[model samples]
Target: MAVEFASPPGNAHEIALTGFQNLARFTQRSHREGEYGMQALPETDVTLSAPRPVHHLGLLQIVAHESIRNSAATGWQYLVLTEDGAVASSELSIGTDERPPVLEQVNMGPFVQSTASALEGLDDIPDVQSGRYELHTLKIPALGAFLLWLRQLDGNADLFIVLSPAPNFLQAGRIYREDELLDALEGPARKRLEFDDSPRGRTEK
Candidate 1:
């Protein structure tokens, strides 16, 4: 059975489970209680391999931030390191309302994927963590900036962490209707669109 360990949107998943011995730079987890009576800090990291080796993929850019917020911030974080083990902060957050990143800047790959194929990687089979914790390596080149964005970001009724990927032109053209990808880009694009219009958030000091 092949188990899949997908990171939650904008959340950090730990790698303390069994079978996940390949982890290089993993974040520790506290047994405190918060979300679900147990939540890990939003800052915790679950690096399976600091610089993914087998795959020259980058920081493991997440396709979802909300999941990051929920799963990562409350419990132990679990993430499979890329082959080289290099994961950046930019691979996480959507960046502050400030110089939010472009799709290409934050996405990882040339691996070429349709929304479906990419998503198919997230299947929940049986006990497959190499007899320990199941692990999957992700690639996010811009992860550093994303983390910086999270740290610098603040002030809101409830700041939301939304994982919005740019238009995978090839995938979008084939998988989704034109409008769907347009919609995905709308929020971030609109936020970016406002860059020229208004000003908010902090500058990197």
Candidate 2:
């Protein structure tokens, strides 16, 4: 004769608890208390492969900067490397008068002809001990600057390290839109409509 175990107390619709003990093994309960009180659960081993350090971090920086520059939109402006060998992209924009500059996270899409992609075959990318790279565009390329920049970038550790600039077109300190000019005007300038000067609107003087 088989021995009958007591069924867990619950309503008729309650699900059966078959592997409850097995599930409990994975989590731990705390016995102590304080600011550093009991942990939510005991640490468990996670079977994930450690990310390998990027061999070409510097080149990727250049590519990322170049990619942003070539982009049609004033999108991502910065390429950042995380301590754990991950690359993140960001964009900086001015907020309204009530707020400071805003830094937004952006996606690092494909790197075709981008500064980051330029490191593909080059073997001499600089080995930066610090994972965080701050890029500044020293000089906007004039005329054949792109070709010259390419030539200077051929495995040159020095150039890649120093010349990473923010890719916003306005980074050169020039406004691109007519509305931007009008927006900069204060008081009467901004309030006056260009149409007011048209012949149709002019009544003598």
Each prediction's TM-score versus the true structure? 0.20, 0.21
The residue-by-residue lDDT of candidate 2 on 20-46, one tens digit each, is 212223323333333333223212221
Per-residue lDDT over 78-186 for candidate 1, one digit per residue giving the tens place of the 0 to 100 score: 2233344323222222233434222211212223222223333323322222222232222222221111001111221111111234333223222222234234434
In order, candidate lDDTs are: 0.26, 0.25
Give candidate 1's total backbone clashes.
61
lDDT of 2 at 154: 22
| Cα lDDT for residue 202, candidate 1 | 37
* Candidate 1 residue runs with Cα over 4 Å from true position: 1-183, 191-205
